[model samples]
Target: MLGLTQSQEKGSDDTIDDLPQWRRVIPVALGLCLAFALALLFVLANRAADDREDALGNQRRSYEVIAIARNLEGTVARAESLLARYVVSVDAKDGQRYSDQWRLAGTLIENLRRSSRDDPDKLRYIGLLRDSYAARGKTLNDIALRTTYDQRLGALGRLYEANRTRDADRIQRILTVIIGHEMKRLNERSTLLDRSTMRADRLAGSYGLVGVVLLVAALVALWVANSAFTERRYARRLADSEARRVDHLELAVQNRTRELEVANGRLRTEMEERAQAEESLRQLHKMEAVGQLTGGIAHDFNNMLAVVIGGLELARRRISGRGDTGGATTNVGTSGVGTGGKSEHGRDTDDAVRHIDNAMEGANRAASLTRRLLAFARAEPLLPAEVDANQMIQGMSELIDRTIGDQIHIVMEPGAEDWRLWADRHQLENALLNLCVNARDAMDGKGTITLSSGQVTLRPGEINDCPGGDYVRLSVRDTGHGMTPDVLSRVFEPFFTTKPVGKGTGLGLSQVFGYIGSCGGEIRILSKPEQGTEVQIFLPRSQRSGEREASRLLTEAAMAPAAPRRSVFVVEDDPRVLAATVAALEELGHHSVSCDHPAQAADLLAQYPGTDIILTDVQMPEMTGPEMIAQMRARGIALPVLFVTGFAGDDAEAGLLDNEHVLRKPFTLAQLDRKIAEASSAPARGHKEAAA
Candidate 1:
């Protein structure tokens, strides 16, 4: 029995040794399975993260492209505004600004080209945008070049007549289309981002659940194994590593979500700003329309004033018994009374003269008012000449005293003797008179008005909208209740007035502003409540002198040695004006042939082959005076022509009328006689053709 028990114990020892080897194999297999599952989960998480990152990158690119397009649109708008301002102000700085903005827009287009390379449709649109921008840029460049070469009138006409649909409007439409496309892309990207995030979340959840199931199965296997403590320790370390990886992935996704939110916020802000900008553009367009309307009204008003003034002057001459008998073909008598200033109807001569004088004064005032309107409209016919400001101020001292009243003290502060300005002397005088009148009113006709002048060297950026150069500065200051900031800001605006109704025309400062700008000058006003006001005008300094002498000589030549009586052919559209013109020519001791239409001028000239001078109105129905002249030239009729106009604003026909003598409307008989003499001395149109 003892021997049998010993053999059984040895067999039991062998079985125990085999059980340990099997135990080691079971734990190693479980570890391998756990590692494989972790590896698969890692790969799935990494793929989800990469897909989300790609979606985010695409969204960012869409935002960048859209922003760039909007910026490019704004740049184009700024460039156009600068070009328009240059046309009006003729300021070189504005032109330079336009060029700079245009270049920036080009750079933006290049950026767009780069941004849209991945999208075939966007690339095609980009190409179209670039081509359109290049064409538009070429047009603008031509305009700027013409303006630079002093072809301002032609440049302005071309600019105003530019085909918006083909150029600017087309560009805008393309930009809108581009923006809309990008907006669609943005929406798609947003949807993609949401889907990517959701997919990542689902992938993470499914993988996590699989990992947990694998972990639980490994734990259950470990619990049954003989090496349970070692297996459990290994499994715990792996679970900890997996937990850290999941936390890191969740943090990364949250960060991406915040980034997308930030980009969306920025887009919203840009959209609001663009809305405000569009509103401002609309306001500017409205103001431009008002300016055009004002100019048109002023032009028509000037023509009517011309007729009224001419009729009144002719009536006064007839009543004064100064009418001549050389060409009394009109219904009105052209015969002078015998040494007695009496009418043919036996009316009281002195009373008629006084009433006529009062009427003449009223008409003259109306003429002055019309001139102010013309100046404000920037359509005033400027006759620029070199002027000595000191001399002019001195000459106007007596007139200024009488106009401003004795109660108001006038202080003249003249600059250096060599300081001179190249401007229209008459317009300059009108500007000064307007300033003085404004000052007198501001001070209630009792304060000191200082008229000062000096030379100044201006640097770039020192003055607003003015170039760097040597300038002659004229300042008109008044000691009175000064303007508020609100009023001062709007003082240069046309038709804006602070005075009571009928007390001021509201065009004084605006006319002065236009005149200064037209003369290549700038005006600045400084004032504060109760601190008095100072109006400073800076005009370009003249490089030449002896202008006064030249002007006086020309005036004398026009007035001296009036041409002998000859047949004058007059073309007028208004019958009343035609009758007055014929009567005036008769009174000037010159025979007249009158036609009421420009179309009839050629026929009239045909009948009257001995016509010495052709005097025609510039703006006529059916055909313009210049057009009529061109037709006559085409027919080989090279008669010397004289243009009579109320407002010489036909800059398109400026080339045709450049060499032709022009006489402004509401002209006196002496002015008429002088113009006739000047026209008679001019070479025929054939001479101009030959010279050309």
Candidate 2:
């Protein structure tokens, strides 16, 4: 009996083995196809439903419009009827009714006019009704306003005589035309609504039939697959029965052992993956929270700095704001020197200026630290312009050379290769030099740091984390030990560093990332363990401003030589800064008006209207300096505005270093004066149409 069962099972196994591999996947394929068909059917049904709803809505609106038109006609007729009665009986009651009906008619006509637009012809009808209502309203007012019975009757008879003379006929004819036109629109919408309903029904029926057919076919496929599965199960059971009397215990033992091993491996893999994902998620959340907190404090801290610096400036001015009338320049080299030579008082004031300057320098450095912190926090705004990459790099060569020290060899690519990139010049230079310094440190200040530039065009998807464009590439490569993959991965993370503690802030790479990202640029790190590291920055190439010749004519106006600009309107909410600015202006041989508020500056501008330059703080109680300038422009005051703020805000108020109107806090008298010069020379005040 055992041999016979084995033979039968062997035959069944052979038959199952002969089936094609594709046969096993047939049910899944059919199910997927049917799911797609059902999905398409749902979309069709949704579209049909939307169309039906829209048609029905239009029909309802048409009905409402038709009803309103009829009501308007009734009100007009009622007014006309009451007027005729008042004319016949000369009664005050009739006159009142006439007045009320006329008012109601006018209201109804306006309501209809507002709601009547279904087509151009419907609009025309509403306009006609409005015109007729106007004519009728005039006549009705004449009749209703007469206080005496005799006067009321006389007005009504006059209206009646006018009605006989074709005016009333013209008005009624208009009403008739409008009502008929609305009714026509109503019928059209009703017909469309019915047609849409019929089309939707037909479509539903068609899709329903197709869906049923697909479902039937899918069910037949499922049944066939189930039959095959059942046959295979039976064959396995037959084989198991044959083996039961032989080595069944051993087979069960091995099968259980293999199953346990697979389950253990899968569980371990899932646990490790889950742990990694959770850790990454936690770190990301922590960074985001820290960034938000830092960004919020930065703005408020800048405001405090403005107050601090503004006070120091004012105090310095009070102590040392003496005039050198005899062309003896101040120690700061600012113009307007007093005639007196170096006296004991002058020496004390000069010492005071030095002390103040030292304080200002330290404050300005603190401000710079705050700015870097902001950049690391990704809160700084970039004001990008068409910048010549060669010019920018060349300008920074000396600073880069000084900062990296004598141990490092700095090599610039020979010749001035002209390529323009749209970038915030200051931020880009900072990021570039930062990368160079980082490379210098990597080389232990002993290797060559090659600075080079070139242009390349990239197609879409070539560079990761960047939009593809023709880019001006700036590269800083060093002959230093490169980073391993593990270290390189965290290179741009804030506060993540490979250096020993107290040696690095870990914000250098982060700031580079932030500034470049803000300018729509991308950073590339090519490094491996032990090999030299190379960092490439890619900034999108931009067209030169205006024509090439015109761009060549363009100069950094703020840096050019100019005379002392006078007639200054100083706007600062901080009293110290206000006083400092006023004194500074006067000390520089310029006339100035002090405003404790930005609104006061606006008032001053309005009152004088001939102010040369507006020196203002960015943040104040009533309004920001930018707001003051905007308000002044709105009032047709086209005066020059120089926005001085302690800290940067959003992109709108963030000042470019080259912006003449924007000065940072803790600035020297010379810096303040230079800004005034730049503002006075700016052509923004050329808008001659002043605000009234």
Find the candidate with the highest TM-score and give its number.
Answer: 1
Candidate with best lDDT: 1
Backbone clashes under 3 angstroms, per model: 0, 14
- C-alpha TM-scores of all predictions: 0.55, 0.43
TM-score, candidate 2, is: 0.43
Worst 10 residues of 2 by lDDT: 551-560
Candidate 2, superposed: residue stretches over 4 Å from native: 1-364, 385-422, 433-473, 478-529, 538-565, 598-610, 621-623, 635-637, 652-661, 680-692
What tens-digit string does per-residue lDDT give for candidate 2 at 1-692? 99999989998898878778787578678678766765665566556556656765665565556556555655666666666556544577977887897888778777776776557776787777778678867766675555244553245446545555655656567767876776786688667767765765665556545545655776764544344345435534543453352255446545655754665575466446434333433454466578667766775666566556655666675565335322553454233456555666667767877888898777776666566556546566664567887777776677788789988888887233666888766567777778888998888879899888888887777878677778899889899999998998889875566776446656679768877787778889999877889998888887664655552333334323445447887777777567666766665667887878665666666676567777777767757666667777777777777877655556556543334456666566667766676667668652766623
